[model samples]
Target: MEEIIKVEKLTKTYGSRKAVSNMNLSVNRGTAFALLGENGAGKSTAIECILGTKRADSGNVSVLGYDPAADRKTLFEKVGVQFQENNYQEKIIVTELCEVTASLYRKTAEPEYLLEKFGILDKLKSPVEELSGGQKQRLSVVLALLPEPEVVFLDELTTGLDTKARRAVWKTLSELKEKGLTILMTSHFMEEVEALCDEICILKQGETVFYGAVDDAIRNSPCNKLEDAYLWYTDMEGTADENF
Candidate 1:
């Protein structure tokens, strides 16, 4: 399979703290890849470095064969992103926000089509501040997807969503994956990863502890669930320094 994203010996530092140390990751085309880590575990920092929003102190990154730092303008045109916290102007109506987002890209899906697909068509006139958390998240996703990107970076896409809302988002994402869109996502929900990700990378203390197929990781664990496998892997001896 063709690789869509790659990071090699990536490192980022803030003064004396190494936010990400010697991290490596690779995501293939048409695959849903998960980046897992606890708070302050360098997940966000790594993402920033990969997205060209933050510079890595050391190492290299490539997305769709383009260097983010050198080709950010072109990169941004081909990729979409949804941050963990999406903040829109309080009074901007959903349709207006979507329109603004769509205008930025050379090619984009119709705002109404995206909104309807996410089950937020009725929110066309709703202000950002008035929508529920789930609705806001859906809107953020729709904005990210307006460009019809080949690769998407989603950070905590379902952070505050209820079960039904979460499932709805998951179904949309699954459909995108089936259509051959590459996705790199981060979430605290193990079940979400299990359901969507074909491969996962677990970060511990700014380092990768595990990177492999989801089923293989689960099979190696004492329990059948990914949550248990995650715990077991993180607690394993020398996990932080383990390569692959």
Candidate 2:
């Protein structure tokens, strides 16, 4: 498989603390990759460095064959991102927000199509602030897809979704992956990772403890399930479900 995203010796620090230390990972084209870690395990910092939102203290990072820190203008045209939280203008309606977002890209998918596909078309006239948490989450995904990007980064992809909505989003993403869209996502849900990811990198204290197939992770650990394997690898073996 072609390598689409690469990071080598990526490091980031805030004061005396190293948020990401010598991180290295490669994401293949047309495959979904998951970044797994406990809270404050440096996943967010790693992503920021990769996206060039935050400059790394040291290391090389590339996305789509371009240096993200130096070639962001060109690389962003083919990349999309859906953050865990999005803040829209007060009283901004869905259609207005969509139009504004569409104007930023040279070419974009039809807003109505994406909205309906995510089951939020009826909220077109509703103020973004008025939408429910799940509705807002779906809207964020729709906005991210508007650019028809080749690679997308999703932070906590199904955080606010219920079971049915989560499954629906998973199906949509799975289809997109099948159609050759590369996905990089972070989610605490082991089931979601098992369902959507082809490969995974588990981070611990800003370092990669394991990077491989989910089945391999299970085999490597003393646990038979991905969730248990994750707990074992992260050193939270006896923790309860709430930790996830």
Candidate 3:
């Protein structure tokens, strides 16, 4: 696997509060990478720093050989981001939204094809406010894929999705990986993480506790289930992580 994203000793702070510290991550081309951590564990902070929306207090971060903190345009154009929850205009039709997103790419996929891929073509005429939670989530994923981005970022990708819908999305993401698209995702579900990620980066109190292959992380932990392994990894009673 050729490295696509590289970070070295990355750290961030909000005033005196340290959000992330000494975090290093490497994601290979066409691989799916997950960031795993509980709330307020600096998972979002790390992503913000990586996206250049916020700067780290110290350390180095490079996405596609560019500093996200300094050059936003190039990185954003090359990357697609699916937020946990987005506020699309209530009046915008599902089909329109797809078209708008596709227009941003130098060579975008057809909006109709994307809608079909995510099972939302039938909802084309419906307004954003009229769709079910699962439908909305699925629509968002389709929009993210419109540009056929090289790197995609998904934060809590299954937040409002049902089990069946979530599984469907996973299947699509796996297909994207097969096509050599790099994915970086943040998620709370350990099963989702285990199912989707090729490798993982574990954060504790804003610091990296683990960064390696998913199988190895599970094998090193004394747990039978992936969820159990995550608990042992984060030393949690009940918890979550950063996944796309």
As a TM-score, model 2 comes out at 0.95
Winner by lDDT: 2
TM-score-superior candidate, 1 or 2 = 2
* Candidate with the greatest TM-score versus the true structure: 2
Tens-digit lDDT track of model 2 for 1-244: 9999999999998999888889888999889999999999999999999999999999999999999989999987899999998988859989999999999999999999888888899999999989999999999999988999999999999998999999989998899899999999999999999999989999988888999988999888777688988888888554434334
Q: In angstroms, what RMSD does candidate 2 have relative to the true structure? A: 2.3
Q: Cα deviation of 49 in candidate 3 (Å)?
A: 0.8
Instruction: Report residue 153 deviation for candidate 3 (angstroms).
Output: 0.4
Candidate order (TM-score):
2, 1, 3
The lDDT-based order of candidates, best leading, equals 2, 1, 3
Q: Rate the local accuracy (lDDT) of all candidates.
A: 0.88, 0.91, 0.83
TM-score of 3: 0.93
lDDT by residue (tens digit), candidate 3, 206-225: 87878898888867766556
Worst 10 residues of 2 by lDDT: 235-244
lDDT accuracy of residue 6 in candidate 3: 85
Clashes of each: 0, 0, 10
Evaluate residue 127 in candidate 1 and report its C-alpha lDDT on the 0 to 100 scale: 87
